[model samples]
Structure formats: structure tokens, C-alpha cells
Target chain A: MTAARAQEPVIVVDGVSKFYGDVLGVSDVSLRLGRGVTGLVGPNGSGKTTLMNLLAGLIRPDEGRITVLGLSPDQPERLMRRLGYCTQVDAFPAGSTGRGFVVHWLVASGVAPRQARRLADRAIARVGLLDDADRRIAGYSKGMRQRIKLAQAIAHEPDVLILDEPLGGLDPLARAEVIGVFRDLAADGCTLLVSSHILHEVDLVADTVVLMNEGYVVAEGSVRSVRAELTTHPLQVLVRCSHAGRVASQLVARDDVVELRMHADRGGFVVSSRDADRLHLDLERIMLEQGATVETIVPADEDIQAIYDYLVSGAGGS
Target chain B: MSDGRGPLLPAPSLRLRLAQAAAIARLELRHVLLSRRAASVSLLAALPLVPWVLAAIYGTPGRASLGEDLVGFSHFVDGAVLRLFLLLGCMLAFAGLVRREIENRTLHYAFLIPVRREVTMAGRWAASAAAVATIFSSSTVLALALACLPHGRPAVTAHFLHGPGLAQAAGFVAVIVLATATWGAVFLALGLLARRPVGWGLLVFVLELLRPMLPLALKRLTISWWLTGFLPLRSQVKAVVGIPAPPPSPLAAAIVLGAVLAVAALVVAWRVRRLELAYSGG
Candidate 1:
């Protein structure tokens, strides 16, 4: 790696494709992930979980190779030693307490019995499940089960962490706490790859994003850079003002504005702009000069769904 | 690339690998024991003993023919019913040993831990074998004691030591253990190689069942062919099937079982190395 790229990518997928027979798990997918929290945002069955499985060595890609921290995906004994994966699946082996589940996994990882218990305790405490550590996992609530899974993954403090839809089961408070845990791990220089269906959740903690649709990575980079490439797609901004009619007339006069649509029953109008930043400044100028009283201005179409739609529009075609 | 975490777990070694496998066996033992998967077979194992216990305790008219009853019980029930019962029971437990975890979506946790896949497979096999043997072996001993106890303690003692009685009992135990171990390896390998092992189980059953009908040269291939030689009393049913040439000597029978064990170990070791965890793959 060049000095400019000093922190080498921890995971690399080179022209990889996985197929369950004819159905594509992922097609010619390639990615390079560095040391930080990276979010994988995609709709259901868009190959997010499939890609995680490939990295975790739970499945092999039929076509191309995968490397995790300079180790092959086939080498679980080596790859898993430096990595921890938290899956969305909540089913644990029956008849095990939270403590047993975490500690036994640590023991299986070659930690001595006494130390495994101590580490399991710390990990459980970190996820705030210490009180319920003695209870069977099957009896845990959905959010509690989510925390315990996180607890097991972080117990060993592996350098590379992969989580698949980990936050879907959490309440707002637990979600915030788990996100805090991710931040702390990343702050400690751990590489985190987190997948989620919600865009804003990824937007919260991810330093970069890998967006996918229909088994292909639609876009990947810093959220700002990825959003910048959607230049041709109409950026919809919701403008709420007292005199919507007057504001729309002035906003349309600008070259950046593509079109305008009025809200059904409000003092607001949706402005389609080629450049949202220029349109924002122009809207302000138009509002001040027109003496319009505006309630709120929000970017309505800047989320992941809009980006995915623009990139993979014809993917479902036969 | 370091995360600046504390010291890592021990480096992989044979000692640690076996230690990890033993720990996994300990963890899995409780779970397998409490599962309902073995319920039907367990009930079947104990059911045959219930009649003998009732007969032994009460003054049943069949008590006068105690020696014949014991022999019949040893050959027919021990060799046939309980042997098949352990085969099916152990098959159920060991076949799904790895696959059930994959099916339940819990197998990834084993893979997620920094351990060799072989360790987990060995641990699961050990734990399943331990649980199956505990339940089935007890039933075997109970059924034999029930038949022999009412014949009078002194007579039973004399009968057990002097005659083939002791060797016969030992053989039954040996057969149960070897059969469970051998088939456990087979089905565990099948479980690892494919998603649904029921089809493989059926194929093995047909092949073993046809072992007798084939010529003597082919007979050596069946596990039962070697195992049947160790029985203390000759099997009446085998007389009809034809002993072919006289059954191989006891040492040869054991050597054949050892070969089966070695083959089983190789299959398990080979399959687990490439065993990928995918629920849909099964």
C-alpha cells in the first residue's frame, strides 16, 4: 500500500460472485473496506447478508476470492481469530444461559475457563445484560437477545467486527446504546462492517456506506461522495412557507430548479433541483427578497432508497 | 493493524485443539441430553426391558425356562432390537449433530469463535455419543439383569461366569458401543456433506440389509457381518441366512471394527474441514 493509503483495507472482495444455483447471491461484487464503521444499506434480499456470510466464512463464493485482514475466507481458524461477526439471527442453542453462551464461545476460542468467564462478564456488562446473564437465552425478549448476541461477539475483542441487521430488534434506547458500543469499538481502531435496512441509522455512525440493490453494490464511499454522484437524479426538497405560490414562482426562475409540485393542503411546495446546495441558497434569496415567512426546509429525497432507485431501476427486468 | 486490545487467546496447538473440543463436548452434552429428539428411541429401548422386569419380579410361568429366556433375550432382543434401536438412535443424534445447528441457524456461532471446525465436530460427536450411550447402555444392562435375576443369584452368578454368559454380555456391550461409534461417524459425515442426510441414512440401511444375501466375499464389507461373530450364542436367524464360511475369529472381528473406526475418523475429519455453514444449503 502507498503511504497515502497507510491504513490498508482490512477486507477485499475481488470480482466475486456467489450463486445459489441460478439465483444470484451477489454478482461480480467487489469491495475494499478500511478500518472504521462502514454501513451496508440495502433492501431485503439485496445480498447484504450473503456478502456478510462470505466474509465470515459461513459460505464460499463460487467464482472469486475473499480476503479478510490478509487471510483467506477458507481459513476460519485464522480469520475468525481476528474477527467477530454478530448476525441478525437470534436463535441460540436451547438450555444455555447468557453467561454460558458467551463464555463457552470464548472457551471454544481457546481461552482458559477462568478467563473466559471474566471476559464473558465484561462483555455482558458492556451490553447492559449483566442482570439477565444467568437466564436462558430462549427466555430473553427480542431486544435482549440482540444485546446478548452483540455481547458474545465483542467478548473476545476481535479487531474486525461484522454485524448483519443488528439494530432491527432494538428499542430506541438500546439502539442508541449499541450504536455507542460500535462507536467505541471503532474509536479503538476496530474495523466494523454493519448492515441495516434503514438508511438514517447507517448515516448516524458510518464513516462510509456501501449501498446495494438487486445483488449489486449500487454505490459505495463516504455518504457525501456517493450522494454527489447522483447528479442527474432530481433532488426533491420540501419547502414550507406562508406564501408557497410566490416562493415557487421565484424558485423556478433559477436555472438549478428542474420542476415544482405543490403540496395538497399546505403552505409548502416540492422543488426538484439538479443542485440542492445552489437551490438552497437561491431559495433563501428568493424567500428574503419576496418577504416569504418559511416554516421549514428539508431534503426529502436524499435518503438511501432514492439512491438505490436511481442506480438499479431496471434490475428486475427479465 | 492491531486494535490495541489485551493479549489474545492461546495459539492453536494439538493440546489446545483437543481441550477446546472437550470443552465443546461438555457444553453440548447438557443440550443434547435435554432434547426431545431421542425420546422415541429411548422409549423403545426401555420398553423391551419393562416386560422382562415384570416377568422377573412376579412368579410368571416363564421363570421355569429362565436359561432359555436369558439366551433368547440376549440373542434376539439384545442383538436384534436393541442393536437396531441404538443404530437408529445414534444415527438420529449424530447425523443431525452438525446439521441441526445449521438448520437452527446456530452453527455460525461455532464458526464465529476462533476454533477449528474439526474441534467442533469432534466435540459434537463426543457429546452425542456420551448421551446416547448413557441412555441406551443402561437399558441393555437392565434388560439382561431382569431376565437373569429370577433364576437365583448363585445360579445366575455361576451361569454368567463359567459359560459364554459373561462373554455374551460383554459382546452385546461391545456391539452397542462399536455400532454407535461407527454409524455415528457415518451419519455425521453425511450430515456435513449434504443438507438432508435422511436420504443417506436410507441408502446405508439398504446396503447393510443386503449384506447377508451377497456372497461370503462381499459379507466382510458389512459392519453387522463382523459384529455378529462376537455374539456368545449363535443367532438362529443367521442359521437361515447361512454362516457362509464360519464367522471370522474374535480378533479378526475386532480388527474389522477397528478399520471401520479408522475410516469413520477419516471421513469426519475430511468433511468438517470444508463444511460451510449455510441453512439453505441443507
Candidate 2:
């Protein structure tokens, strides 16, 4: 766990289980999210959306309790004022303009009409949709729709934001811009729980991560910590050198090296090491003793994608 | 985006909730007033005026005097406008209050707001009732005016000024407003509870049509029975074939209508409290 998790949690879930009849939505899930972006990473049907919905009070857990900002999800009148959710559902009311949609929500939430317009404009500009603010949402492209949804979610300037795939359907530039916005919100002390299938993007924006699979939280924590906790699945490292067979023969004998495979090109070898820090320290000595010319030493499994893959693919063990 | 305004009105006051509800009502009013459904309901509300206009322009066979015309108009208002047109119009307007949002997948937008669900339901129902009531009430007035058009100015003026014409017009407007309030709530509740609210609305329409033939106690259970007590002209029941039971007193009618409205509102609040955005199944 990161130091952020040790802070006063703004959101707390305890033994939360949700079901749609006999189909499990999320089960036995527990989490504490403090200030900053906590990425909810999961494959499809992995209960990522369901968990977000539960926190946003869109759906209630059949068997557990959740509190956001010390208030229960059931108390929407109190909870929703401090919370904002950008749902995955893409549909909007027919004939609504982007600006009007945001303003309508603000007004409906009791913001004064004049202030709602001002805030709407600010939010539209924040999402970089000022050029299309007055345009009908039905005429917008998918990426623009995503931006408008984000604009509405933040128009109220909520204390806690729950985003379900807020980055879906955006181009690389827009994605980067939105990630910058997420960082800005987190910097302002907003607690954001964002869900995304794009594991690497989550890695970029989230301070901590929760990995869910098949209706369960398989793993969660800082990316490095989660990787460190998976002892069974030793960290994989790609080592490029002038002599692959020599490096593999030397590394395979080490106590920390669990497995080694020479690259197909015979110019490099992939080493699985239980102790990555120790492996890194010995790499220079091993290269010097063999008179090997080392090119690259990259930890292949240090990022969220590899961690997600290992955890989700069952290679890391239950 | 945080202007550092601190948290939103920490505990929303009653005035704040009312403001939120009013805002919702305004938004819902636009949807109910501008849609194709509104056009069809407006046409239905004005349908009773069509015959009156035709009769005013071209005299009918054995055209009756102004008094007889007024009687015939009241029966027409009772049978055609209130029973058929207004009933269907309220069904069209109110049953779609929640269902339309679900169909558009926009219900979550309202549900996510800090306002209470009960407040949202009240706001939507109020807007729909206002729209439907205004349409039918205006049509009723026009129909009454056209019914007296064939008569000379002195006679028409005397009918409205000295006779029961003005009273009948006021009574029709009041009954229309009350009927809209009560029936709108019923249909709104039906929209929340039923998968196919229109089908359930059809069932309600049939039951109302069969109300006059039911036993007196059962007749008291129908909305039309309580509303009939408020009609100024008694000719509507006199024209019917059976020996209709005595109508309830105006106070009793008001109390009964209020009770039905309260019950329907309670049902709507109960249903909306648990309403989830399961748009996929819908």
C-alpha cells in the first residue's frame, strides 16, 4: 500500500457483494480510497463498472456497506453533492446541447441559474469542448461525447469523482490532456476512482491501483508493491547482451534466478528473478566476469500491464 | 475546477429542495410540451371543439335552443372529452414521465443529482399534470363558447351573465384540474411499477368505462364518480339509460379525490425509491 492509502480514507467499502439475481456483479470486495486517483483496472465482466456503480450509489450492494465522505451511498441528498460520476452509459436526452446539458444538471442540483451557466462554461472549457459547447450532443462524435460526459461530471466541482472509462474513445492527444486534468483534480485534493481497461493509461494517472477479475479484487496497491507481493510469479527481466547463452548459463545458477530463456535472435535472454534488486546488483559483475558487453537491462514485469496480465491470466496464482 | 467554495449547501434546506424540484419541473415541462406525444394529446383535447365549430357554422338537423345546446355540450364534455380524451391524454403524458427517461437512457442523470427521488417524482408529475390540465381546460372553455355561438349576442351574454353558463365553465375547469392531478399520479405510479405502462393504462381506461355499470359502492371507487359530483350540469347522468346513483357531496368528492391522489403519490414515491437504471432489460 502507498502512503496515500494510509491517509484518512474518503471512501470505504467493507465486504461489499452485489448480485443481479444469480449472476454475480461483485463479491467480497473491500477497499479504502483516500485522496488522489485510484485506478480500477479489470477485464470485461470483471465487476469494475459494478464496483464503481456501487460507490456512486447507482446500484446498492446486496450485502455490505459503503461510506463516501463519512456518508452512506443511500443518502444521495448528502452523498451526491460531494460526489460526481461519469457513467459508462453514453446516451443523453434528445436535442440537448453540450452546454445546456451541463447547466441543466447544475441547476437541478440547486446551483443558481447564473452560476450554473458560469460553471458550465468553465467545465466545458476544462474538457476543451468550448468550441463545441453550443452544438447538439447528438451531432458529436464518440470522443466529443466522452468529453461532454466528463464535463458534466465535473461541472459541479465535486469533492469525489467516480469515472467509469472516462478515457474511452479519446485520441492520444485528448487522452493525454484528460490525464493532465485528472492529475490537476487530484492535486486539488479530489478523490478520484477511475476505471479503465487501458492498463497503461491507468498507470500514468493513478497513484494507486485496484485490479479486479471475474467479480473479485484479485490484487490492489501501488504497481510496484503489487508486483513485489506476487512471489510465485517472479519478475521477468529482458537482458540484451553480446552473449545470450553465456549470460543465461551464468544467471540460471543464481539462487534468485527462477528461470531463464535465451532470445530467439541469440542476442539477448529473458530472466525471471525473485529478487529483482539483487539481480540488478549482480548483473554488472556477471557481465564483467564473462567479458560480456551489456546493452539493456529492463524489468519487463514492473508495469501495470504485466502485473494485470499475470494476475488476470492466473499465472501469479490465487 | 474547485473554486474552493467549500462543500455544496452542506445540508440542503427545504427551500433548496423545492428549488431543485422546480428546476426539474421546468426541464420536464419542455420535454412533455414539445414532443410528438404532446401534439397527439393536444389534438385529442381539442377534438370536442370540432363538432361545436361545425354546428356553429352550419346548423344541424332540429337544432335546439341555447339551453338545450348547453345541455348537449355538457353530455359531450362528460362522455367524449373527460372520459375519452382527457383520460388518454393524462395516460400519454404521465405514464411516460419516468419511462421516457429510461428509454433515452437519461434517467441516471436525474437519479445522480443530490435532490431526493421523491422530489424528482413530484416535479415530473406536477409538470405533466399542468400540461395535460391546461390543454383540456382550454379546450373545454372553447367548446362552451362555441356551444353558445349560434345564439344572438344578447342571448349568449345573458346565458353567461345570468344563467348557469359561467358556473358550468368554472366547474369544468376545476374538474379537469382535479382529474389531471389524480389520474396523472395514478399513471405515474403505473409507469414506475409496470413494464408496459400503456397496457396497464388501457386496463385502467376499460375499468373507468365500466364504472357506471358497477354497483354503487364500486362506482365510488372510480375517479369519474368523484369528479362527476363537481360538474354543474346534472344532464350527463340524466341522459344515461340506468338509474344512476346519487353523486357524492362536493366535500366528500374533494376528500376522496385527495385521498386517491395521496395514495397514488405514496405508491410513486415507494416505487421511485427503489427504481434502478436497468435500461437494458427495459
Model 2 pairs whose backbones collide: none
Candidate 1 to truth, TM: 0.84
The count of residue-pair clashes in candidate 1 stands at 1
Query: Where is model 1 chain B poorest over a 10-residue stretch in terms of lDDT?
Result: B234-243
Q: What is the TM-score of chain B alone in each candidate?
A: 0.82, 0.91
DockQ (Cα-based) for each candidate: 0.37, 0.46
DockQ-derived CAPRI band for the predicted complex in model 1: acceptable
Per-residue lDDT of candidate 1, residues A1-318 (tens digit)? 354444788899998888888888898999999888999988787889899999998888988889988888788777787888988886898788999999889987888889999999999999999999999988999999989999998888888889988898799999999999999988876789999876677778899889877688889988767767787776889989988888898888878888899989758989999887788888898899899898989887666556656665653311
Global local distance difference test of model 2: 0.85
